[model samples]
Target: MQILEIFGIAVALSIDAMVVALCWGAVQPTIKASHILKFSLVFAAFQALMPTLGWFAGGALYSLISAWDHWVAFLLLFFVAVSMIREAFEKGDDNEECECRSMGSDIAWGKLSMLAVATSLDALAVGFSFAMVKTPIAMPAIVIGVVCAILTALSMLAARVLSEKAARHSKKLSLLGAAVLLLIGLRILFEHGVFA
Candidate 1:
């Protein structure tokens, strides 16, 4: 594949990660630099790793993985969305001061890992496609990882700016983020023909 084609595919695959990062930024009480760096690294790693696995696994595991990948992604995203929604409602004090501490307490590593996997499932399938076409995986995987990292970081930063600007409406923003996540999950299901 040409470099442009690979970059196009990388951008397409990174959409989920970008959206998820935005949601995470929107719902967080405060977004620290560590959170952004951690999220970008983890997401980029998964985005790179999944495609490589898919390419290696190839047709041998295609049937099995394709059968339920969408469902798994949907479930993981749904869980995060529900958590965001619950957190939005659970906050009793709108005017409460936020400590702006590390996000470790707010977002557990397990959840972050799940989100990473959830967002990268499509990239896994893309890897399988590349294998089928005999396309080189190295360049594409690197492009996908780099693009996803850049886009996710940008999305988080954009959300942080918006969140700060509308600090008084944090609850509404959280709910909106949760709703967007739910829609993304549903869209994934629909794309997989789960609803058909």
Candidate 2:
């Protein structure tokens, strides 16, 4: 529940949002500040909301599983890290293929919402982990939301700023992000004294 720990978790949880926003940035004919703002807001909202929802759900089950809360937290993070790594290696769709290049992608509310939901699923699990560990959800949720928003915006800007470089390194970045998550998960286990 330390601030640094929460921040680490937030960063780990935001990787998906960042990648998605990066794709959006690349596909648009021209990137704008407003577009970045919109993507960040939508992605951040879902990332924040999912955790709060998970926290509530986890709260209901806390007393029933208090003894193994740390284990659950560690497991949740490990699973999320694994999932991210898996996705990074998965086959790319045409949209995914052109992630760091300009392509005509229609931006709509439904698509944005779906993307938001898809990217925030890990945050939902993270929220559950927070609840299990008795971590206060408010501060952590805020950190996650803010970090996700910033990362999403940055990814978009970075994509546009260095489209060619991004195109070449996007997968490597994703892999690095997943590795960070894996480390964060291990850190959580260590911090909880679960592996000591």
Candidate 3:
């Protein structure tokens, strides 16, 4: 594939990660640089690795991967979103100073890992496409990884800015973020014809 085509695909694949990062930013009352960098690196690793895996697996396992990847993503995202929303309404949440359900604004490995996998699912499919086309995977994978990392970080930064401005409105913003995540999950399901 041409460089531009590869770049386009990379951007398309990275949208999920970017959105997820934004969700984190919206839900997090405080933005930590360490968390952002760690999240970005983990996401980048997943994005880069999936395509390579798919490329190597080639067409052999494409169908199996494709059949369930979207559902997996939808499930993970939906679960997290619901958890965020539920936590928002939990008892003893009236303490505005409390970073309740905040996950310490630290890196929660479980959710973060799940987010990385969920966001990188599309890139796995893309890797399969690259394999089918016999296109070189190294360059494309690198581009996809780098682009995803950068976009996710940028999105998080934007969210941090918004977070700073809306610190007092963290509850409202968290609810909004959770709602958006739920929508994103449903969108993934709908896109995969899960409820069709």
Q: Which candidate is the best by TM-score?
A: 2
Candidate lDDT values, in order:
0.70, 0.78, 0.68
TM-score of model 3 vs. true structure: 0.60
lDDT of 2 by residue, 91-116 (tens): 35323444433324556777788889
Taking all chains together, each candidate's TM-score versus the true structure is 0.59, 0.85, 0.60
Clashes of each: 0, 0, 0
lDDT of 1: 0.70
Give the Cα error of residue 15 in candidate 2, in Å: 1.6
Quick one: best lDDT, which candidate?
Answer: 2
What candidate 1 gets wrong by more than 4 Å, as runs, is: 59-105, 161-196
Residue-wise C-alpha lDDT for candidate 1, range 34-58, written one tens digit per residue? 8888889889999999989878876
Which residue pairs clash within candidate 3?
A: none
Q: Where is the poorest 10-residue window by lDDT in model 1?
A: 96-105
What's the lDDT for residue 22 in model 2? 68
Model 3 regions more than 4 Å off: 59-104, 161-196
User: Candidate 3 lDDT, tens digit per residue, 48-111?
Assistant: 9998887777656546666565665556556555655664565224434323245456767887
